[model samples]
Target chain A: MTTFETSVPAIEPTGSLSDSVKIHGLLAEFETPGDILKAAEQVRQAGYRWWDCCTPFPVHGLDRAMGIKPTILPIMVFFAGLTGLIAAFVLQAFTNSSGMSVWAMVWVTGYPYLISGKPLLSIPAFIPVIFELTILFAALTSVFGMLTMNGLPRLNHPLLGNDRFRRATDDRFYIVIEARDPKFFRTRTEAFLESLGAVAVEEVQD
Target chain B: MSSIRADQVGGRIVDNTTEVPGTRAPLVLNMTTFGQVTAQVAKVSEAGRAPLAWYVAFAGSLGLLGLLGVCVLYLIFTGVGVWGLNTPVAWAYDITNFVFWVGIGHAGTLISAILFLFRQKWRTGINRFAEAMTIFAVMCAGIFPGIHVGRVWVVYWLFPLPNQMEMWPQFRSPLLWDVFAVGTYFTVSLLFWYTGLIPDLATLRDRAKGRLQQVAYGLFALGWRGSNRHWHRYERAYLLLAALSTPLVLSVHSVVSFDFAVSQLPGWHTTIFPPYFVAGAIFSGFAMVVTLAVPAREMFGLKNLITLRHLDNMNKVILVTGSMVGYAYSMEFFIAWYSGALYEKFAFVNRAFGQYWWAYLLMVSCNVITPQLFWFKAIRTSIPLMFFLSLVVNVGMWFERFVIIVSSLANDFLPSSWEFFTPTWVDIGTMAGAFGLFFTLFLLFCRFLPMIAMAEVKMVMPAANAHHDEDGHHHGTPAPATGGPS
Candidate 1:
């Protein structure tokens, strides 16, 4: 209550855990994937939503830890492929049949173009290009959509600022209980993380 | 049901049988390193001196290719009258070779694209070489058509343009379609093959000892990094290309088939050509794959990568397609009998029991009969037998085309127009030269290119099987499962 006490950076009482609590903006390292997963599960169970997992390689069930759903890439690729099929079919048919003025000349020339009594606009004939277009479109969608969804071409990140995060390219795994999570209290979250087998717990600063 | 042990100890079936003196339970090498991996692969070589044989075969092929060059020169100087190609039979050997080469290219795409889509993992071992064969074979196939037009200089006329001449390639013509189909196929297959090579090129670049090697590989690699993001994009692109290629493969051959089928030529005017040609294409392609792979496995020490298992799988494909081709043969005969059309009946009869009956029988024996042996596992698994069978398949496939082209053209409805067409020295030389061209390029590709995809192979290692193996390990834990904080 005194002016000197306010200037002295407000020392907290030892009895009150909340008043004595300290928050560190850094993620703790995990010695094994199991340790990281345990922490992630505890955080998830406690109803903390804002969290992420980073690893050297894609770790199985990491998506579950981060509460991430399956990607819409397959759907996007399917549609893109469908578009390709349509484009190829239409283009080939038009060019082969109606688009060219050669039909009129052939009719007049009387060159006897008949073969096995098959019609001009054959479905079997067009199948090849149609199939080709489907693949072309789907593949393009997969490549482009994957890039766009990942928010790639990013030259910098908050994780890039940390030296410890560099080990994400090696044998390290990380589970960050984000500040935005509702259950992320400064002291309680750290204590909870320590209890869930995290080797060290620190807050990640943005 | 087929247990060797007669007695049991406790609850477990146990045998107190002595190990056979000669058979020490077949010591399977625990492949732990790349060097050991190479050693295991080397052991798969049925012939230790095969690499030396490869050098001799390559040298011989190169010589033949050179002889083909001389023949082409002779033809260029002497004009169209060098040998045969008189009047109605003008297209003979040139067209046959063209069709043959184009058919050869089909196997590459069928092996690479369709097989890739089906998740046939065995394809990974042979697809690379098959693709290389496709490209080279196509190159050989393309040359005949280019030069056969007489004025090889004016081949650009195939390309549609609003030029000073103000003419267009006949859009209605199947030949024009052949140009489009073949051109598109070659371009797309080239891109598909190159895209797959980029990552492998990067691997080679890292391993290169010389400055030139590094620069060459680096250029081809396009600065590929194994970043997961890059891999994600690359894999998607590759899948798309493979998808594109499946249709492209079919179209290329169908277009080639149309060259014969769309016309009112007696033997060629059938609706079954597309499927028939596709089956034949795959049949021959598998044969070529076997031909190249059997030798390549022995020479490049890729037996493990291109295992007996892979060969067995390819042999199965060959058998299925070969049967389809054989079915086509039977159908052609049935259609001839069923249609009651004099020309169709004559064409079919002429093809089988006609003047070129030997050619027809050769085709049947090679394409139809030999592939049937694949039904037996022992025959399919035998390296020497499969090699011989592959060669037979290739020869039969060639004869099939020969019978189709020569027999039909040699004796058509009008006897005056029908002439027995024989290949000239030039024709024989050029075809032989194309083999030379294929081998020269292939030999270089083998020496230079990272023939095996090391990165891809590495990705398939036990370490990469972590997820799948976990399910396996739940039943058998040799060590305390490392499933906790270390």
Candidate 2:
């Protein structure tokens, strides 16, 4: 393991499985969250952009340790919520207060409903629907935005095929650095991960 | 902890849940491990057969659910006349049940959202099932409103839809606001609950033995690899959902209250209705949670996870919210007298001394008197006492709604319109069936889904602490943290 350096050429890891199968990544498994956190910090320091730490639960500060940036999900949700607010306002105004008409699946017109001779376009009356829609849209967007961003609901993932990596959702911690990463030299990266105190390292396949 | 434990005033054994003043008690007791938490939660779902009690409970619930189905079918075939809906007492058991079930749903959201916001890690133990309860309670609630419409076929008219009638729902109506509010609440709560279920479902997927379990858990698990990069976004989304649900839960009750508050009736028309309803909802919701949780923990062998501390904390919430509800009741009376409104005064007096005096008394006794018993540490921690009290509080809350709706609507200002609201057998059956529906759904959920949030429990484990750099082995004994809920 000490014979290789970071600049070593990309050598395919051998003697683990059939060479015919393509390698997807190198999976370094650790026993506890602390071991993984230690490895993740060093991996981040080494500047591996295409690597990730997998754990049973979210390890606090692991994102910072891995040099991950804050998510832009809130900004996206805010705009989605804003869209809901405006849509609710428009929906209520068009159907209840405004004289304007438009086609939305069918011809729609503002009825200007006069309740007890109260003022038309009651902002106070419109508020509950607006608030509900905003929360509704923002909530739905947060879930879907997260799923879309995370590339979820797929039938399979390469990491799921690795038996040693199965503990990633259990007691063990893992660091998966894909072969797609430029810094990922098959044997050398395995050596680097082993040096970081991984209990067991396995080759993941596509 | 030692100081408190040593000063046993009467030599009575103090449960670990009792306040120790300065020490942080670990959330998980009996030295649980990460793998064990996953195993304990996952095993219940994966077991080939549920226990005999589950079967009995399910059969009974399923029977009640069938009764609910029969009641709905009868009501649909035989109009709203099947129930005792007189002129003035148009809204009796239906609205009461609707509000009661919706109020019960609030506790779950409060646990999962508000507690999460406040960093109450103890919520992790109970949030999954609590959220499940919320969903089921809302489902039960939704049925009443839809069925109560009588012409159930055109119930969609409640929504702003372009129909053959060429008419839209009145957006200004508080009833329409109710439609929007409850709809939004149900959708958001489902999403929030499912989001929390994802990682736990992944655990079930990983541990799955049968083909059916694998495909089912796997599909819902959604290929979640639990990458830290994903966790970053997932956590943020959870935080956002929590932020969204906190206000959403509060708003749902407020909007529901507006259905009554905006009315011309004295008891129904009040500004305090919004906050009062919210507090009552939380109070009743916590009671319902305790009632369900007491048996669930024992039945599923989750006593260590859903500890006495969690129950004690929930009881404290019940006490606080219950006191708030009591205050609102007294305030309503004060306002009625202070405003010099004759109808309002009569509404208050009639509520206590009129035809439905018994219902008002029960509400006050169950909601106000019973919950005050929680002020005692001994009563709060005792499982049996809390469980009984929880059931009592649930009844009290329902009667509270009954007194509010029926009494207000029944004893109208015009004596000619005044009528006593009496529920026929169908009405009683529907309410019972609603419980059956709630429990049936809940039982199914407990049987199929990961009833506890395994991932969340593991996150709070002492071994998960960052300071344990020496933990190269999986079984490294954790040094208990001084960081539990104060």
Candidate 3:
């Protein structure tokens, strides 16, 4: 199993952090989605795991090229929805229904008021709340799951230090192979990226 | 390869710039390049200051918002009795406006979530504003129920929280269901809107020249670096949210309909209320979208972006849903007579030919008769006519709620209790204030945010990226390479 890195707390430097720190990675700029996909494939074929492609928008087929496995978001969302459905049912049954005996004494004091002569345990009346809660949980799970899975809200990353890297969100694409990768060698990786037709290659510092 | 022809359809010039081979018409007109799409869309947000007309509209909206605040304060100081709540017509304009505004909110979710899932590319042009309108309209809708509780301070009692009184809110009551439905709808819509806005905000953050703008945009951008890995998760989450919201769009209004449908009221109690209400909601929602978009596109100089085709498409939706609403009207009448239920018969009859007959006529003309004009291509595409008809639809929808609530109640079972309900100054002022609140929030949104989704718009354009081959020749077709070098 390939274990993805979770959020790492940034270590505070004693003095002159930029000067003392090792280069974070090499960011190679590509003009088109095709170029980045090609670069990603080369890096993946070379067995470089600590690498990612950045684009302004999603590039179709790029995931296959980069050898990224399908995410398990749907499974997470499904369980969340089920939890909500059960929780809603339990809540309504406890609050609006009757008869939970403890020992010889009737300990349950549920708010079981009769509405329009309808039965206390009305399943039809409970469906709306169940449906809403199911959706609410599923939707919230999808968002927080995505964020958690992606390790987001970090608010800062070493790649952001590269001035040219800002264009990753606007009219540019990049493939960055981190220094932490096992296959990475400074001169060899730089040459490999340039050979792949990178428009510009720059060192991203921590 | 011929581009511009002398032929004109629906008052729009048949220009070659938008034409795609084998297609009769273009999806987007005059969108030649990716840079033009970005520059045109980003300019609205990055232009340092808005146009004079924006300020004028904003000022007017703010004035109305002030009036709304005054009316709300006065109502809170006094009571629900300040308005027109009597014996028979207990729910006059407050609930009418509540249902009306909530109905208007439906179109935004339908456009942003449903149309998106259906792969309707045209929605890219208007979904941002539509979603924003949904949030604001729901805000307006929430105020009515909040204030309608009579004792505003104890409004929290509506929730099922543990209280000192050892009481829980009645779960079976549709009104309680409404609190959950609307509250959940508002929360989810807000999350969906903000999620969509992140990438666009990042684009704006990259383009911001000033310190304050950069900081503000950057904070909201949430440190987005557009990593394909993040995009992968973002896309999945977005798709799931859309799927979740589709059911919510139906469920929210169905639950709202339940507030009436679950009751034994003559016109209100029917199985058909859910679908009928959903249809009417989308109908009025589309009309409101048109009413806002037509002026917004003109004021923001976004003609090339939000072109006549968008307006024509929305008008088509209005026609379909309006017809559905009309069909519901006829169905109710037919079922009432066919069922031989005297009270239901009286409810339908009293709505049309009774004292509130003029309200019924206005509803029919504005909703049913007026939308019938869209059968003409000229009427569908005409900006002025469409704008006027959109407002007419708004008025018609309001009166539809009025007729359903007032007419049904004012002539219930007992003749002695039947009395006409009339609105005082407070009711009118408060209702007008809701509009003020909507426009006020909208105008602020127009000024601050990227009113159009820049990234999504670029995705739809043909020349979004410049592709070049090894020989340095520009390739018009997508690269045949499915994967990187094997």
Candidate 2 - chain A - TM: 0.88
DockQ ranking of the models: 2, 3, 1
Question: Which digits, one per residue and each the tens of the lDDT, describe model 3 over residues B1-486?
Answer: 222221223235533234357653544466554456666777888887899999998888988899889988888999989998899999999999999999999999999899999999789889999999999999999999999888999999998666556567888889988988998899889888888888888878777789898889988888788887788888889899999999999999889999888889898988899999999999999999999999998998887678787888899999999999999999999999998999989889988999999999999999889988988888988889999999999999999999988998899999989999989989999999999999999998988898988777766654332232243543333333333211
Q: Pick the candidate with the highest DockQ.
A: 2
| lDDT head-to-head 2 vs 3, winner | 2
Q: Which is better, 2 or 3, measured by DockQ?
A: 2
TM-score list, all predictions: 0.71, 0.93, 0.91
CAPRI band for model 2: acceptable
What is the C-alpha lDDT profile of model 1 across B1-486, one tens digit per residue?
111211112223222122445522111113333333323432322223436766787788889888878877787777767756766566777887888888888888887899889976557667777888888888888988888887776779886543444344444567877776787677777777776676566555544556787677667765543333345445556676777688778878878888889878778998999989988998888888888888887877665567676777789889999999989999989988999999989988888888899999999999889999999988888889999999898888778887887787788778777777777788777877888888888876776675655444443333322243234332111222121211
Clashing pairs in 2: none
For model 3, the docking class works out as acceptable
Q: Which tens-of-lDDT digit does each residue in A48-84 have in candidate 3?
A: 7788888777776676667666678999999999999
Which residue runs does candidate 3 get wrong by more than 4 Å?
A1-21, A98-108, B1-21, B24-28, B464-486
